[model samples]
Target chain A: MAPAEIRNALASHPFLEGLPEKYLDLLSKLAFEVSFGQDEIIFREGDPSSLFYLILSGKVALEIASPGRHVIIQTLEAGDELGWSSLLENTSKQFRARCLEPVRALAFDGARVVALCEQDHEFGYHIMRRALGLVAERLRATRIQVLDVYSPKGVRAQ
Target chain B: MSTASHAAAPPARPVMEPVPVQIRSVVKETHDTFTLTVAPPPGDPVSAFEPGQFSMLYVFGVGELPISISGDPAVRESLTYTVRSVGQVTYQLVTRRPGDYIGIRGPFGTSWPLKEARGKSVLIVAGGIGLAPLRPAIYSILRHRGDYNRLVILYGSRSPRDLLYRKEFAAWGLLPDTQALCTVDYGGVSWRGYVGVVTTLFRHVRMQPQETVAMICGPEIMMRYAARELEARGLPPAQIYLSMERNMKCGAGFCGHCQLGPYFVCKHGPVFAYPEIKPYLDLYEL
Candidate 1:
């Protein structure tokens, strides 16, 4: 996509809804559009975190491989972000992200984005705050899932 | 002397008697849950019920259990119940065939606030079998579509296979001003819908908290979390309702078995405003 179009997309995204015009322009310069087919593994666990993603459309599953099974930890869809770990330096992915449907997303090089953040503290603060919100939301969801609230035993206990 | 003695005896309370109704049909909803339609004898129609009311079902040689009415309230010819075969009584109730007779008592308890919600959007949050109780309210709102604004249904189940009324959910989503979304706690490779707890889906839908009335069901923990999230989104406690379940023996307040705080769940409610029961909900071993 062209730089102007990328900037427009970033501006419209919920995560960056109120991002300043200059930052949108800066982030757009670092982002490139990417797409993947269904069932493709975008990144595997322990893979070097290279790119951060903001999903434009379709679904992806965050999963973990267990003995004889693959457990889906959560499913992210349009308007959701993936690969927050990429924002940190020298980190590896904790979960495998696989496309559950054909997906389109905006990809940003982690090192370049990190450099931009350091250069512009205000921009870095905005980005880090949103990422922290996403992490807290995911942690809350994970706790609810662990409760097994729908089990028959859980119902009876209530 | 015999005539005087007979005249002095008090009459038995008709409300306590179980009326025999024949099972019309049974549809297996999932591996463990079944929906049964029961009808009163010919020339006698079953009493109408508001959404969220429950009936005490008695299976001969087994036992009686309280189940929410899952059918449309407008259709008074028969009453429907969705039963999960988790115990001996529920198992026997689900296994009964057509032409079999089972006893049905009062279609008792409080109902969803459909009357108050007529001019505003209705938000339904159901988990697992909790959907069964809320299904009737959905039907009522759809039947009188102009009476309400937006209709949003957020449903969550244990997995893709455990979802109820799968086809109906698609149909509901197709209606104008209605949105239906389903999520599961777990998903297999082929499942493409939202995979998360019910609360996670709250952010995806837009609501005018002041103009919305929310009804929630499922396990107590799920309802507690759902209510908390709705409150965080600016909905008041009075506008939120939850269906509470307990070991109910008598369908009337005479039996103290179903007591929750100051109320009897069987008589006073299976549906209660959040604040009315909020304190009891968090009380340990209450």
Candidate 2:
């Protein structure tokens, strides 16, 4: 994608909806377009979290492998972000992300973004705030999933 | 509480009498749920019902249970109910064979506000079998498609296998102005749909909050969360509705069994505006 097009995409994403133009311009410099085919593993659990991605289209499933089964924890779609842990330091992916369909995303190198954050405190603050919101939203969704709210026992108990 | 009246009141209607209807067919919707279609005796066509109304179904020699009428309101030849076999009465109700007779006491209770919702977008959030009651409203809206603005359905269940109306979800999503999305709490490797609670789908939906009427049903807990999310998204409390469930005995309000606060769920509602029931919803075991 062209540099101008990349900036526009970053500006349009929900995560950076109100982000200042300078930050988008700076982030765009560090962003590159990436694609994955169906069933392709974008990253596996325990892998180094090197890149953060903003999904442009299609679905990706976050999953875990147990003794004899692979369970999907959640599915993220267009306009959703993945590899949030990459925005932090000394952390690795907590789950595997597999493309459910052909996927197009904007990928950013974590180390460069971290360097940019340290060089610009305001940018760091804005990016981390949005990341925190994303984490909170996922935490809330996981809690509801843990409740097993749709089961007969769960329904009656409520 | 004095029983001294100048004249004795006339006897009330026999609301307890159950009208025997023959089961026309029983379709298994999931491992634990069955949709039963019943037809009334000859010349006594089944009564018409508004969407969201429920009936007290009696399985002879077993017991009776309250079930929402899940079929299209436009088709009055028969009434359909989706029963989840979680107990003895429900087990008997779902196990009955075609041509077997069961008693139905009503097309009772209040219904979805489809009339008031005309010209407005309809947002339906249902979890598990809660979708059964909301299905009628969907049919009614689609039957008169031009009368409504948009139809948005967000449904969630325990797993992909537990989803109701799976084929219809695809059909509805194809409609010009309808958006239907389903999610599950858990999904296996083969399941490709969204995996999250019903509330999580709200972010994907676009609606004019002021011009939309929200209807939700599920476990009360789910409804509570869904309603809260809708309100957070700018929907007015008055425009949001929820279908409440309770221990209903008499189809009429005569029995105190279905009371919730100052209202009798059977007579006053099975469907209530959010603000009207908000206070009582959080009260434990009320």
Candidate 3:
């Protein structure tokens, strides 16, 4: 997709709303569309941070590899963003991202965005705020997951 | 407490009267859960019930426990209950044979909002064996498919092995306008499905928030979280209903074992709109 089209797509997502015009334009220019077939890996745990993605369609499962099993830690669907580690310094991908279906996303070159953020604190703060919001939400979800809050207690499997 | 007044009292609803039933069949649903089909004794009338109503099952030598009717309500010959052997009564109930007699007193409690849900989208969220009580409601909806628009079922279990009606979910998903999504708290190497709480499914479902009605049944904490999540997704509290679980001794209102503040869950409800019970939900000891 063209840069202008990419910008339009990003604008449709609520998190990308209210950004400075210059940063929006820069992100648009830097963003490119990416897609993966079912079961395809978008990124692997410990992989070098390269790009972050804003999901346009379908779902991505964030998982961890164990001794003999792949445990899905979370599932992200349309309008969800992933690979925030890419924009944070010295951090590698923490989880494996695999396509749960045919997924289309707007992929942004993370290093370039980080460079731009360093040059512009105001723009960087706005980006950080949004990233923090996503992080908090994920943390809350993880807490709920860890609790196994849905499991029945007293009578056993009610 | 006057003898004359006690004798003059009107007869209880037939649903509260214990009737004899014979275990017709028992299917082990998972490692610990068993689905028991009980047939009423010959010449006995097995009351037909709406979805979400429960019955008090009496294991003759053990005790009586309240269990939701898990079979299709339209089928009048027998009632089904999916029970997990968690206690003395439940263990004995599930271990009974095809010819053994057990007492059944109910078809009690309020039912799922089947009529109110017509012509609108319906969302059913169930956790663990909580799915059994909601099963009849799903049967009712699917039987009258034209009455509703979108039908979505979001279910969460401890594991793939713990999912109830595993074979039936696929068939339900095949029906027009119906969607079934299952998630497990944990999955093994062979399991390949979403892994998360039932609330996580809110984002994946497509519905006209204003025009949809949601019915949820699960552990108390799960319902609390799910109701909040649904409200956050724009579904009004009034449009979201819940089926509650409490220690129910008498299937009628006479026993206070199942009381929830002002409501007797056995009589006034097993199903209540979220707004009606929101205040009591989080109260300590409620």
Candidate 4:
């Protein structure tokens, strides 16, 4: 993708809404324009995570395996963020991320974003707030699954 | 979610019975444990409560739990409790600072029967941290010295250090009508108090079986046995009130986690008159 297109995409994300144009342009320059083949496994369960990516094209499937079932927890499309564990700590990918079709995403080393955020309090605040919201959403969704509201014995739904 | 554009308390309508409380101070009462003082929020009034009742405390990010009030009834502005950090949510609780908000949904459930114990002997039994819910009842009894008859409290702890409200037991015992008996499962070199289960303290308590009402709270195993001992001594099942703790997710009756038979502990109890719950609670896994 061209530099102008990269800048446009960054500006459109709700997380980067108030980021200055210069920083957005700089972020686009630093991002690696990465691509994947159709049906590619971007990362497997338990793999050490060090990079964060925002999809530029195509789709990615996030799934977790338990016993005989593989639950499709979520699907990520173009402009969606993935690989958040890299931002949290030295954590591994919690779920497997697979390419549904040929996909393109801008990937960045997690350390680079951490360093940038450390230097920019405004940017850091927005990113941390977004990260916490993301975590809360995941917690709520998993709780919904565990409670199994729709199951007959799980909850009466009253 | 910062407070600037936050939603109001989940109940929508204001909580009127028990005051909306805030954390005024957080004290570490034991290893990896804490005691919080919840004072009335700003202009809210203090809530009236009985000895055995409870309040639902909600912490953001973390979840909610049903905690019994454990402070003096006279000090209505701030309520205090010693809570062990046993789970993830409680771990978050100990870390909260003064002025941090906490949601209080109750003063729910039936309280210790001060009226019934007026003319007869009253035996208060507690095991482990189960004392948290029973302390307010103990304090209320002590506060109203002549309103009741003989006062005897038998409290059991895992060790010397775990006995809650260490400062108050002595002062309470000084009251003309009160007698506080504290025992532990195991005693250290410095431990001079009674050693053995709290039930052993019952052997020392002599009362007309039909004349006394015992409010008991503790581990399920201990409560069951305590009831057995009381029944052997001739106190009817109808006279023993046990504070039962189930995992309460939502304080409302909606959550099923606290279901024991058909009762929701969060709403219906966490406390019940003995006869009302004994039949179902005796059934397996109830």
Best prediction by DockQ: 2
Question: Residue by residue across B1-286, what tens digits does model 3's lDDT show?
Answer: 0001001112244656678888899999998899999887543444567788887888876888889999998888888999988778888988999989999876677888888888999999998888999999999998898999999999988778889899898788887788999988766544668777888788779999999999999888789889999999899788899988887888678879889999888877778888888999998576
- Tens-digit lDDT string for candidate 3 (A41-99): 99999999889899999878888989877887777778889899888878888988888
Q: DockQ of each model against the real complex?
A: 0.46, 0.54, 0.46, 0.01
Maximum-lDDT candidate: 2
> Which stretches of candidate 4 lie above 4 Å from their native place?
A1-158, B1-21, B42-46, B284-286
* Model 2 RMSD vs true structure: 5.0
Error of 1 at A68 (Å): 3.6
- Native-vs-model 1 lDDT? 0.86
Against the correct fold, how does model 1 do in TM-score? 0.90
lDDT of 4 by residue, B52-80 (tens): 66666777757776777777766766777
lDDT of model 4 at residue B256?
81
Q: Write the residue-wise lDDT of candidate 2 on A9-29 in tens digits.
A: 999999899999889989998
- Please write out the lDDT profile of model 2 over residues B158-219, one tens digit for every residue: 99989988898889999998999999988899989999888989988888999999989999
Per-residue lDDT tens digits for candidate 1, residues B1-286, read 0001001111133667888999999999888889999996544423567888888899987989889999998887888999988889999999999999999877777888888788999999999999999999999999999999999999999888889888998899899999999999988777788899998889877879999989999988889989999998999888898999888888777889989888888777788888888889886555
Relative to the true structure, candidate 1 has a C-alpha RMSD (angstroms) of 6.7
TM-score of every candidate's chain A: 0.95, 0.97, 0.92, 0.84
User: After aligning candidate 1 to the native by TM-score, how far in Å is the CA of B69 from where it should be?
Assistant: 0.6
Q: Write the per-residue lDDT of candidate 4 for residues A1-158, one digit (tens) a residue.
A: 78787778788865567767767876887787789987688998999988888887886767678777654545566656789888866789998877766888888788778777799877777677777776775565444334422222321111
Sliding window of 10 residues with minimal summed lDDT for model 3 chain B? B1-10
Clashing pairs in 1: none
